[model samples]
Target: MEKYWNWEGNYIGVRQKDYLTACDGIILGKFYGKEIYDQNGNYIGEIGKNNRLIKNKTKENFRRPGFSFYVKGTITAPFKSCDPYPMIPGYEDFLR
Candidate 1:
């Protein structure tokens, strides 16, 4: 495992495991409680699992640099708002 501090002093952890798997695991843990079932649909022991197809697809999309960039590249205005949309910090380079 490797650790680094961001400019804001937030400690970021890096694992030897693949980043995509780690991120999916994180999403699964956040959305689904600790319980996974086997293929037979039996109540298996508790384990961090991702059962949502949409969420898993999103994770896959985020793993691709181009796909992630395209999704984050543009901002859509609200249907009934004049307020300027907020830009993602450190994404000024992308905008240019």
Candidate 2:
């Protein structure tokens, strides 16, 4: 499994240690206090401790319509994991 980081270069979370065996590279694990951002660097939300992507509701109401809300959903995209390569180096330091 691999780790992930936020746009501010902060450690966010890590893929489940045994994620490879469980889901073939899919990420599933506890997330630290990390804020998620959109492509334009806008604050989106944060991954909760329950491994759910909790979107920032404060910003959702005004965003473009038709955008799927992930407020209480888990990230199901298997390719969205931070494995193979991480945005920032040493993100695994928080694992300990």
Candidate 3:
């Protein structure tokens, strides 16, 4: 359903090594000093490890050397329900 609809967004660039490291260290990095438990055996909340872990992971991702990658540019349409970009008229314009 998401692919069927047009959404305006930007791309993210990151390194492969960083990605793997982040994925492997996520659960451990999310460890807060305090832990919360629910009535059942489920876990509820943590103390102060949300934003800190995210920032650390982001830094780690950018630190990898020569790991450059880019994504497609963003396009913002005038109409919310439609994509008014690539402004018609020339068949050759569609190629881009």
Candidate 4:
């Protein structure tokens, strides 16, 4: 699994195949190609535009979906990974 970080370099989660697993081990969402969907199958965002891990264009999907919050101990610490893409100017408002 490849670890992902926010624009501030904070470890957010890992990308295991098609799923984005949080640091606490909860599966945050899944990727259908570059399109991201919540565990409930809601269209959230797409991973695109200069390799952005996620880009939420709509105001919807701002809240977490109904997924189990149990920590399954998937990630222990930040692993060696590439730095996240640079933050886009004026794009934060559309973030998920």
C-alpha positional error of residue 50 in candidate 2 after TM-score superposition, expressed in Å: 1.6
Candidate 1 local Cα displacement, residue 65, angstroms: 7.5
Candidate rank order under TM-score: 4, 2, 1, 3
lDDT digits (tens) for residues 1-96 of candidate 1: 322222222222222222211221221111123322222332222211121111122222122111121111112221221222233332211000
Candidate 3 structure quality by residue, lDDT tens digits, 1-96: 011111111111111221211222221111123322222322322222211111222222222122223212223222123332332222111100
For 2-95, candidate 4 gives per-residue lDDT tens digits of 6655444445576776777776667767667766667666766555543445555463555434444442436545554445565665344113
Residue 26: error of model 1 in Å?
A: 3.1
Q: Which residue pairs does candidate 4 place in steric collision?
A: none
Q: How would you encode candidate 2's per-residue C-alpha lDDT over 1-96 as one tens digit per residue?
A: 444443334344445432211123223222333544343334445544334334445544332222223222223333343323332332222221
lDDT of each: 0.21, 0.35, 0.20, 0.56
Better of 1 and 4 by TM-score: 4
Candidate 4 local Cα displacement, residue 33, angstroms: 1.0
Could you arrange the candidates by lDDT from highest to lowest? 4, 2, 1, 3
Return model 3's CA RMSD, one decimal.
19.3
**Reference-based TM-score of each model:** 0.22, 0.29, 0.17, 0.55
